[model samples]
Target: MRFDYSEFSGDQGFLSPDELFAPPNLMNFILQYGEQAMDAMANLEDEEEQAFIQQLIDAGLLEESTDEDGNRRLKMSPRLLRGLQHRALLEVFAEMKQGAKEGHSTREPGRTSERSDGTRPYRFGDPIGELDLPGSLQNAARRQVHRAVEEAREAGVEVPRGLRLPIGITPEDFQLHNTEGSADCATVMLIDLSGSMMRYGRFLQAKRVALGMSELIRGRFPLDTLQFVGFSSLAETLHERDLPLVMPKPVSIRDSQVRLRIPLEQAYANQEKIPLHFTNLQLGLRQARQILSRSGAANKQIFIVTDGQPTAHVTTHPATREDMLYLVYPPSDESSELTLREALRCQQRGIRIASFALMEDYWGMDWVGFIEKLTRLTRGTAFYCTSEDLASTVVESYLTGKKSKKFIH
Candidate 1:
């Protein structure tokens, strides 16, 4: 987007014209993940890379200042990440439309309907369209007419001044129009925590995916919510704060570190193991259904990150004798049948399930066949990703994917 040079003509101070528009996107990413971006920038010592960085700084996309050593360092600004860019875009678009249709009725879109549902109480700066007509007219008449009658003799003016248009709408006369807003969306993320995930570094992969996806959602979709669930022997939900530290302990801390030792001792003493049901695909699907069933958003989606032979039960109710069992005596009934059952469940609930799997381990590699079957049955896509790019792959796909309709039970 080009910055309007004319808008900077009368500016009295520091910021240049290019700087005004450049800040939004730059500020957004910075506010979303501050130190991460700065640290990433630190590693780029090439002149071309530095120049590219400066372009962003000049555009006001980045916040830059001199360090104690007098060297310039770059960082992202927070305002851009908080929907300011979107809001500014909306405002500019509205202004453009208004300018194009100037002199036409300023009637708002979807207004003129009789429903009082849109009526909002008066506020200090609201425009005149927002006024309660009866109250405003009553106040105006009392001031323009009744006051004239009561004060005419004292003012020494003619008994009635021919009709007056009560000096154009005053600041107090402006009334704001009220409108209803749509509800926010709620999302649930399910990650595979089966034994196989440990083999291919899939667990750590899922952690990165969770962190990046959360940041993305929190930034672009401010009104939406996200929940993370990891399932293995059983499903355990994760909190946002837990994502960054999910992997190995900080290697810098020595075993002799007193501070770390104290905490470790306490944590281990009180550590409670969350329930883990066998990689029961059936149980996870059933639980996910129950979770999505209660969400109040207009839409919902489920993302499963895993690499395992789904071994859970299938039916919503007790198993019947005829419900075929394929494995016995140290049974390995790792059939695709149960996966099909879960896919059907997701479909029935109008839930879209996107699965991310890895095939790096002897046992985990079987996940390829299982994920293929499930993705096809659920009408959701499957991804085969490397550990490094797993998070990016999943997040990119989700943010750009078509939004699906909410399934009603």
Candidate 2:
């Protein structure tokens, strides 16, 4: 067969390698554009284009899903979502070059047979087979030399041959190699879906980082727990399959200096009439805290990724203690203060928070102080970077800030 090469054309052979659909590019496009990309699929009219999409369905990347109206719609298959997550993880790891190993390390040792870097004095019942022979023998020889010198000196011996101290291994000289420690961790990642996040490519990068974190926990630290919470006017737990379709809620109300409050129950009843552009950090933190309270993991963490400060916060009525949602434009003090208060509550519950602030096209560091203050209040960590560096920054923060849980013996 002769080699065939030509300029790219939409009418070219479908089976040709060059014409074959690339899954990564398609997935990336879908995730980057979110729902809009999926909607675009309905506009294809050519048979070849339809065949191309059919190929994706056949490959198990996309599937026919029904909407609430019982209409057939194209939705991402779980396999595709997993592939994107795995790709994001690989990209982040590639950028980081070297990082922590797969499994989380526990502070307590001697639970497993795998050897770690350090050794400790052997205790009764510790497997003798795991003893560090070199260390044990060294200890025995050192004690022997010290005693031999003392005996020689006491005898006033000036012989060329030096007398040695106690020689040979004893129970006291046995040392065991410290076994590898592994611990499970519960992590909740708060992603900002505020209108501002749709700018500077912030939303896409944050979403990518979240997906990457999911895969990292699932593939490497299987024992660790992971969840993603996207917060706008309210917080909602996101499933892995729906991540690619996620997008920042558009700004429906643009009025300046606005203040509104709705009872939580009423808000749920009129969810479709509610605005979705406000940043509700308070509810997000609370939801995460509540989710983690059920986990028995050794460590718990909350990762916050946002491009702006909280523009809204959830509260309770003073007298009835009824749940309420508050929205304030331009991020009023009431909103920020409430968000910080929620963060303090998280701190009291022993949840570690790491806030990643996206500073692309931002006016000043002053605007970013809310998250910084929240971090300080929680005694957590803060990272500032542009959308371009968000993935690497988040990945590095997660890997380096990991703390092993200590076990009570």
Candidate 3:
């Protein structure tokens, strides 16, 4: 089986350019699908496919090796993972540009005080110095014409063509300025790698966001510090080179039964093969705090990407009149409270938490309120989004938070 760059090119093909640039789709095909399926989807003849495969090897995007059984397979090279990350960042910035033209300003605090590339509806207490006079006048003129038409229709009077009315500028017609800014920041991104992330495909989205953020920081904010941490039963710091190799274990009844059947001896012997199935948010936060504490950057923050509530925590239990560390599983109030306590500890150390909740329904199990309270206690913010918007949301939140401190003071 071979890989073809043409498949992702913007020609008449099975995948559109937008879809090809999307990190989730590209990473899914490379990670989840087998080589044979990818070859079949590429639809190239054997000779063409083999040539493309050779090209990929020559370009250092893939490496070919044979197993002990003499079966050959292709594996992703670190270069390819880095390339995918760059592509994801480009796609996100492109989408942001499109959204800006459509009047969708970033939700960053104090954004209106930065500069004027566009205008937005003014609210009460907004500074008058930031108002866009031309835009406000145009809005008032449009409103006057609209009101005249509505009045004519209501009074049963004929509305004269090309009628003009005095324009009235009201507070409702006021506009505010918007702009983008940059700051030196240190960010630790914590991705949930528990069983639920795999079940709902949240893991894939989180990976894409991490990669995009890495690229964004490297290219745009060269002085910024960015770190990636994956957490399930525990938190482990991952470098950019280790990202593509990390895979979460899927949740399934069969897998659970198999795990249950494993003898304790054998399970301990094969510990490396087992994947973490519970969320240990406390450990993740602790690790993040440690990383940030070592950084000298004045602006430090944490971005947590998860789809559910905290399901595990670290605690000490009394054993033989001694305290022993224990992991609490299946999510209890104790776990949730411990997680919040850790977040507060981080907050006290001047670390801010920006949480992205991938699920939409907050009412289910009260997960929404849980996330809100978590962010609120940390003096940060929470965002509810879908997989489609995960990368953009993460990037924008970072940007918003980055600029907020600069303008607030």
Among the numbered candidates, top lDDT falls to 2
The 10-residue segment with the lowest total lDDT in model 1:
253-262
Look at candidate 3 and give me any clashing residue pairs: none
Pairs that collide in candidate 2 are 144-165, 144-166, 148-164, 148-165
Write model 3 residue lDDT over 150-180, tens digit each, in one string: 9999999998566375567899888877644
Error of 2 at 18 (Å): 12
Ranking by TM-score: 2, 3, 1
Candidate models: Cα lDDT each: 0.52, 0.79, 0.68
What would you estimate as the lDDT of candidate 1? 0.52
Query: What TM-score does prediction 1 earn?
Result: 0.44
Query: Which digits, one per residue and each the tens of the lDDT, describe model 1 over residues 195-297?
Result: 4455556665566556556665666666667787765534456666544333321122123211111122233244243213235455456567777788876
Write down the TM-score of every candidate: 0.44, 0.81, 0.63
Runs off by more than 4 Å, candidate 1: 1-185, 245-278, 314-336, 362-366, 402-409
**Model 2 over residues 1-409: C-alpha lDDT tens digits?**
1246889778764674223333677868887889888877745779998898888777676777778987658877777777788788877877764645544455568556368888899888888888899899899987777777777798999533543544667889998888876556799999999898888888888888888988887777778788889999988998777888899989898787778898978876886898988899999999999999998987899988887888888887899999999888877888889889988988898889988888765465576778767867788887777887888777776665643211111
Residue-level lDDT for 372 in candidate 1: 66
**Per-candidate clashes, comma-separated:** 13, 4, 0
In order of lDDT, best first, we have: 2, 3, 1
